[model samples]
Target: MTPSVERVAAAAGAWLDQAQRPMVLGLCGSQGSGKSTLANALKAQLEKDGRRAAILSLDDLYLGRSARAALARGVHPLFATRGVPGTHDAARGIALLDAIRAGQPVILPRFDKARDEPAPQGDEVPGRIDLLIFEGWCVGARAQDDAALACPVNALERDEDPDGIWRGHVNALLAGPYADLFARIDRLALLAAPGFAVVRGWRGQQEDELRARVSRGEAQGTQVMDEAGLDRFVQHYERLTRHILAEMPGCADLVLNLAPDRSLKEKP
Candidate 1:
């Protein structure tokens, strides 16, 4: 296994060894900081050691396009573009965790980015999961100060949300339901990218991989983003991602500082 995977797996194994009941491990990272890679590795290694584990991705909890359209009408126009805090169904995420802790069989949610909606079917986790790897770009993000929301972080905010209503709304959701959902985590780990500049490149590479998958008939193509679209889409996440980078490492249970190439910068 890779160094990053090994480190995360070791930490997760230690957590499971001491956990009496099912536990939720939140893995937070930038858009392409390898959160999914580490989450899957932890699950595989845990299972190899004879424990049952499942992954619950925050991406899967995204509100469908229609729901987001309603959010846009009721909240901010920026809600129509996903990836921010208010765009996810935090109540559903909380209920999923609640069921897991209750020793119940669970249906894991999945999102279809190409269709901009939840998938028609979800994977099932039966017989009580020993560990739940809840991974996402902003899995355990905290809201920024109201003062922080007054400034635009990028062109997307400056040009479209000049009054800061959209970002303010996102911060409000983070401080409310999202905070409650994240508080359920038994342990939290961070995969810290070197900086947001590297993050943009990482996210662009993900889009490239998706495009390749689409060409091979492995993924749907309808919502595939071109370079320009990807650039703008990533900007939607910049402010909060920057906040997490600056704020989370100080408090996260495990912090894996990543190099620009996405390799571990130091031992955890």
Candidate 2:
């Protein structure tokens, strides 16, 4: 692990030491902000210390492509995209967390983003987990007021969703089920990027890595996005990303600000 990962994980481990039973840690950040990497590192460190930990990603709980397509047909076209609030299976996520807390064995769902569908059920996790690390791009985001939704944040919104229907629907999801799911977190941490502009570059780097894997015949059936596609794809997340960047630091229990190059600006 890099020194930054080690430092962040060590601090998380220390926090877990004093935390209460059945601890749930929420790691929130914008796309490609290293939330998943940090969650894995924290889980590894905790396990080494003899603590049984499980990592759950919100991405894994996203609605399948067919379901999203149905939603798009019924609600708004933008619902077809997986990154927004309404696109996740929030009820299932709540039930999983409830089962984990109730001491029932649970199999975490895994989503294959490359294939745009849910993967097979993952290995069963013991219900009596000592720690659960839940990570997502908008894990701790709250809904915006009606007045705030009036403005378009980007070309996608300005052009495709001129009436604000899509964003309004997403904001409603955040206010309801998403809020309930996030409330399960005992402590929250944010891996904050310098600003929204850095997200496209970081996300582009991830696409390059994915492309490399595909070229090596390691990632078959993965639908990797090109530069133009990636730009449009990220537009789905731009508004909420900016919202979280503005508000999360003040509310999160811990905040690790990241540099433009994706290095830790300071130890958590």
| Estimated TM-score for each candidate | 0.96, 0.95
Candidate 1 ranges with C-alpha deviation above 4 Å = none
* Model 1 backbone overlap count: 0
Pull out the clashing pairs in model 1. Answer: none
lDDT of each: 0.90, 0.87
lDDT of 2 by residue, 113-168 (tens): 77788887675895588888899999989998899999999999999999999999
lDDT of 1 by residue, 123-149 (tens): 998768899999999888888889998
